[model samples]
Target chain A: MNGPIIDITDLSKFYGKARGIEHINLEIGEGEIFGFIGPNGAGKSTTIRILMNMIFPTGGSARIMGMDVIRDTKKIKTQVGYIPSDASAYSSMDVHEFLSYCIRFYQIQNGEQRISDLSELFELDLNRQIADLSLGNRKKVSIVQSLLHNPKLLILDEPTTGLDPLMQSVFFDLLRSENKNGMTIFFSSHILSEVQMLCKRVAIIKEGKIIQLEDIDNMRKKQLKKVSVELADHVNIKSFSIHGIENVITGPGNMLSFMYSGNINDLVGFLSGKEIINLMIEEPSLDEIFLHYYRS
Target chain B: MNKNLFLKEIRRNSVSLMIWMIVITLLIVVTMSFYRTFLENQSKIVGMLSLIPKGALQFKGISNFNDLMSVLGFYAANNVIYMMVLGSIFSIVLSSNILLKEEYDKTAEYLLTRPVTRSEIFISKLAVLSINVFILNLVTALAGFICMELVMKTPFSIGAFLILSIYTLLLNILFGAIGLFLSTLIKRAKPITTFSIGLVLIFYFIYTLSKITEGAAKMGYLSPFRFASVDATNPAYTIDLWHLAYFIGISLFLTGLSYRLYKRKDIYT
Candidate 1:
């Protein structure tokens, strides 16, 4: 409570010679909705697992609420709720049975009411067997279980894999409401839009390393966009040459497409006198952004 | 041990344990039902058994035809193999899967993330394995006792019968420990049921081979089955101290090793 809600210092995990994560340092303040974004197999789960004490780190250390993740895992888990990437529950158990099992782990008053409230919010049938639930429904169950105890810090790894758009909206809204009530969240996903929607700050991991860490607004404010221009007539590359234009490609119909990373106004001013049939500026996809980061 | 986890595990495994108990107790009853017939046709049966190779008879744990003269000997000869092999299979399969099944079922995320330490989880599961093994032994052995009482032409020594029951229980527990050790040694979360059953058979094969072949008598020492003496008809029969030490020592060593390995195991689901 006195410091960062979660602190990971120079953390590293190696599976023998293969890398899991290396010297990955992070600090998340209290009441923060922090995002950990990376492509699949990019050590996002590795870092979260270490924090949850599901696995140990090969080097360095991690702590939550000023207690070591390994040594104080039992105590830390009493206040931390985690939803794993895969929505695999005890399939033999019905929703009510499984949820009851999970809630029993925590000492709380009115646990049955808490289970019912969350299940209704997710539209989960209490009597439906987990094995019979759809992927989306199972994801809903996974989500509800993590919130049953109202943990102070929630760790979600790819929490929205199978939910429909409507349920996703409900889930995100619930997350926002939870954050408003001072529950710090560590949300991990490969989807840029979702991370960008809810997270205040994010750390982008690439190939088992923290490649980029910045505020979500700062990330967007970096102004990296795909610029595609179709000229009325053919123009030499020198005609529209400007700072921040990269990977320029000339195509049929005089289309010039490239990535732009600098001021949009400067580019607009430079294009004012040019005869252009169409000019487009769009946000790049997460992979494209990663490529840009790698190239930069 | 965490009582919540222990109780949950017990409930989860109850059906399988119940099935094992029923099957084994039934086997004992069915086999013991023939004790009166074996006595009624003793002369004719002796002639037929004499023609059969001694080693073939010994493989079923019958050291001599005369061993079957007593009711306890008949039980040891006819019914011990069912509990020995099937009970071992049950013990091993249960132990091997008790911890790793969470990983195989991809429910380790739920179990490992709980507000419980690894030690508590390990010990709780181990307790379940032990209790299941004990329950199976108690129920089947009690069934054998009742069946013997019903069919006995003359009363047999309860003391020797108790000793035989203890040996069988010890052997089953040793298999359970072996299974736990094997599960922990596995680097992946795949079911090792076939491998576990095969190990029990292989050990039985070694014990039988040592008994049947004069040259391979020393090979029996390599099998835990050799240490479980089944000669209930012999007046001098008792639980050997060295054999007891071997079973307890290996079981304790394997259980300890499993606990240590599981605490630091890099679980992947």
Candidate 2:
């Protein structure tokens, strides 16, 4: 890798006596949509907070674009756009006023165009007060504010939460465009399908530890498939046993279900030799992969 | 960055500022009007002043209507105490929102992710609070002076009132800094506000107790409110510059402490 956009080394955080996160080490490449997948209370938010420098770590350090998160927070913050898990703005302010206020703070020149672009992209109404906005609309405002400055990096925690499916797709499309423009997008989500659809690579976290980190394509290749077959009459299911077959489920009237890993050539050959009436092959969903990680 | 943040703070606290202005103006007007009515009853007013403690009577210098207006000016100066306390409360609540509100509103993650240092953010907020305190004291003093002129119809020393106003502004800044310090230490707003009010009351009570007891009079130095002494006619009414220095020193110290704590503190939900 040329240089990771984000380099976290053994970053740990503690809430009083309770462990928030521990020994978390990761490096995210530039222009990569790295999905941080973890369930609630799995330390995803804690890690994001540390990276943002909104909270100090109990031990270790995090860096963005090679700058220390603590010592160089101001420089780091200018380059990054963040959408928190729970998106909220000042309730007393109207959407336009709030965005304008943030724009002033960021000191962005020609900020009007940026505001217009974001408001249009996110389908946000700038005239409405923040208190009057629904959770989903408020989330849209958060998204607009993050992207308005055209940051080089976007750290979004559960960015799609509270968004309707249509708006979620819109947000995904926006992220895709930003990624294409070479913005490093790092986000966490418990919604595996969203990760599967949007991320080229993912790190699965469980109990505050990274359980797996792999390319989505590589993960798909490693997936196991279940093949079920029904024969014309009762038969010995053991006769169909083949190499690379993990297990087999046999039922009355020659019904057989085989769980196969790796390539299924041998099992397919055996099935072709048998008098199979009907057959079905099922690929495990993302939910199963998540459940498998938790169970293990 | 400082200018932008200061303007934003002004905008945020505009409502409280307006409320303070209206309430303070009306209070000055009503008090001045009542003093005018009491001045018409000169014998009765003098009789009441005679009943006060000899020290307070001598300090007020009330022998005529002009002196009576000066006495009322001394009492009106007490409004500065109320303004300082209220302004400090507002500044603390507002400045605290600059950081803690980000956490409460779940915006800290977004804000910190921006290219800005915690120090810069903190300094900007402190500047805003200072400017707010200055404006508040200026407005209160001007309104009080206008009300006094309208009611008393007498020429007063602008220099004396201006000096008193500067002292009042400094006192407001001191309290404002204290409020900012408490905000950084406490997470929630309700508890912080309640605690701050209680602390101010305790300080005031302590100062009052010191006033009533000769041996314990030294304890008044501990109160932030004790530094304001507008009755400059009596030599004893002259404020100790060392005490003023201590007040400013403590305010600056608290502000520094708040900045240090906020910079390193881990924000949690």
Lowest lDDT sum, 10 consecutive residues, model 1 chain A, at: A238-247
Candidate 2 per-residue lDDT over residues A86-132, each given as its tens digit: 87777888999888877776767889889888898888888999999
Cα lDDT tens digits, model 1, A111-181, are 99999999899888999999999999999998998988889999999999999999999999999999999
For all candidates, the clash counts are: 0, 8
- Which candidate's TM-score is highest? 1
What stretches of model 1 exceed 4 Å from their correct place?
Answer: A229-232, A251-253, A263-282
Error (Å) of candidate 2 at residue B157 is 4.4
DockQ of 1: 0.78
Candidate 1 per-residue C-alpha lDDT over B150-190 given as tens digits, one digit per residue, 9 for 90 to 100: 99989999999999899999999999999999998887799
Whole-model lDDT per candidate: 0.91, 0.74
> Which runs in model 2 stand beyond 4 Å of their true positions?
A105-110, A222-291, A294-296, B46-81, B84-98, B153-159, B187-191, B213-219
True contacts kept of 1: 0.68
Using Cα atoms, each model's DockQ against the true complex is: 0.78, 0.51
* Residue A221 lDDT (model 1): 79
